[model samples]
Target: MREEKDARIIKREILPYLAPGIAKLLWGKDDKFFAGLEEIRLRIKSPLILKIGDRDYTINRRGEITTRLDDAYVVEGEDIYRSIASISDNSLYAFEEDIKKGFITIPGGHRVGLAGQVVYKGNNICILKNFSSICFRVAREIKGCAKGLLPYLIDKNGQIVNTLLISPPRCGKTTILRDLARMIADGIHIPFPHNVVIIDERSEIAGCYQGVPQLEVGVRTDVLDACPKALGMMMAIRSLSPEVIVTDEIGREEDIASIYECINAGVAVIATVHARNIEELERRVLFKELLKSKSFGRGVVLSRRQGPGTVEAVYRWDD
Candidate 1:
């Protein structure tokens, strides 16, 4: 059943964006290979690479994994062009804004990261051209992943405390945050449901594609996809009247101010940041004031020591 699901994901979500021959080659691989798949990298004039778990492997022309560089399948420029065409639906101009942002979020919440010549309009990036490499980062939803953290996040009054999730990249912080949104919206482990709003700056938390979430974020959740975090939080407060606001990777000065506004509005907040531990988070100039003010009632540290989403420690600021 797992293999079948994995195959279906690769077929529906991944293969369509690959070149025809390359897609056929990948489809021939065993289902188990797709099960642990995390990323697929396509580079012009380079070997096809796959990142599974913590290790990287090269794919040969025969659809087999090999360590020998000479045995690997060399990706051609045509493959890159064809994949880009497919990803953009043959209209690259239509995705100009997304391209400028360096990635395109496809259906199933998969993010295709682009690399090549950067086009500049004045001081800001105008667009990307001469595409040379693309990375497909798979987004997987794990329901009930936040169960263990419920006790730490929820207060005795049955309301969620202002919380911050700290983790390094690829530690499943986004995955855990997604599940936390769902559980909070659905009233899981809580007394009643709350109107939860997700400020998805990168479209990672809700995995929203074309303004609709591809992942399950509960029946009552509202997502503001691709909006700036600080702006989105204020917008949600004014229009959505959300009881709780969730966002990922909040570190900017404006983000801190907006979080303060949310607190003043009597809305709970759940946000994530990139940090290996509390000490590292404190060393940052921006977060110092937030920590001193005790804006977050609880802080959860996550790591990949056991696996992705592993909870390392939970700190109570009020203590």
Candidate 2:
């Protein structure tokens, strides 16, 4: 109870700081969402905790995530706990199912979230289930995202030809990739654009929903969701035979190995890694496989001063 109260206070304090896009999402420019959410507060029962735009409230029941739709969730069933209704059945399976499927849309369009046991096989995540808290980090789309870095990358062909973008944490590597993918797939005046295969490890790119992409990427792009980079690269090489391979945040042992093979196979690679500066990045052992001290390929560095996805610097290999 004490913890929940603390969280509520935090929620209120942070409400004013939501991102521009996210603020529009939950509350809308007219504040309709905010008002709608407020009215829904009256319906929540016990055991269900609700955190909307500026405040946090709790439900009186366990299945409140679904029941508290006006503000946060849209309930799927009766107020009574179905799993516990059977007397002998104590498992909260029914309630858990709704929680997994429902989304937590916070005020800034940022969403915090919860889930059940993350089912996995080897490195593959099969599914997520059960439920507790939910948080959506918030989603934003930047236009002309890669325009700043194009000059350093594009060649006589007008296309980047071959290049890599590097960044640390939320520096916008993926955003650049998304714009580049869209631009490339559309066959920008930049010469012959070829097919692109995106190994989206986290369904963020192209955000395919109902078989369609929630995010705007070019038409010629194909994506593999949740698969590791190496396996996806190998698959693209064989099946898609793409002209270029693009992916985000690469630096694993397997990632280095796969990229090396891709380079050897004569496939151009566009990838990013979490590094502050090239000097700082070279220290990482995995990079040795892709970048040699002076003979490294071109790279784009991102930093806050440069802007959210600002291009800090570009490096070209001695080769």
Candidate 3:
């Protein structure tokens, strides 16, 4: 039943934005196939590819997975154009700003990455044109995924601790962060519900589309979609008065400055970074400084040994 629901979600949320022929090709795939689907890539004059886990598989015209490149369906320029049109609601101009950023967040919180000719305005990007490749990254909401980490994130006083989640790319850092936000905001294992704010720089945490979250972040959560981390943290502090601020992929110096500001304001912060382990994180100058400051009360390391979001270890920094 879960697989069936996942398949339905993909069909309803992601397929419509794809080219008609491509959508038709994927529509007939079995529920189990869709349940494990992670990403879909379409490149002009290239074979259509589907990513499941860490492996990529080519798809044939008959909606079946194939190992032969010759049997795989080749994407075309027309398909790319149609897909762009569908995703943009036929008004590509309206999404020009997002397109300029190389991706757009669709209704289901799924992100479609675009790559093509870069139109430059002086030193900055003006727009993207003549799309050649589109990668659809499916977003899945795995509620309660962060349940085990709650003990490490909460203190004896029931207050949420300043936590950092460390993981490499595609290891479910965002997914875990999302679930943590939900659990903390909803007071799942804490004393009571608290105001949670998500600084969604890339719209990946809450997967907000048009100022509303498409995923289940929580009732007490407020999201700042597509906003810079530093600016969003200040905004949440000044306006939202969040008790807990959640953000992903924080390593920039400016981000560190904002984290200190959050700490001074007595707001708990839950953030993630791309690091294989604590040793790797400590090796980086910025992260080393962060560790020296002792800003994070706890650190949780994740990996893909068992699967994405596999918690390898949790460390209490204050200890």
> Which candidate number maximizes TM-score?
3
Please write out the lDDT profile of model 3 over residues 1-319, one tens digit for every residue: 9899999999999999999999998888899999999999999999999998888888887778976888999999999999999999999999988998899999989999999999998999999998999999999999988888887888889999999999999999999999989988888977899899999999998888998999999899999999999999999999998999999999899999999999999999999999999999999999998998888999999999999999999988887
Model 1 stretches astray by more than 4 angstroms: none
lDDT of 1 by residue, 104-201 (tens): 99999999999999988789998899999999998888888998888788888889999999999999999999998999899898888899999999
Q: How many times do residue backbones clash in model 3?
A: 0
Q: Candidate 3 has which clashing residue pairs, if any? A: none
| Candidate 2 local distance difference test against the native | 0.57
Top-lDDT candidate index: 3
Q: Model 1 Cα displacement at 301 (Å)?
A: 0.8
- The lowest-lDDT stretch of 10 consecutive residues in candidate 1 is 61-70
lDDT of 2 by residue, 140-244 (tens): 445577765655656655644456677777677887888888777777645667688888765566654333455677778888755678899999988998777
Off by over 4 Å in 2: 1-130, 157-159, 293-296
- Show the colliding residue pairs in model 1: none
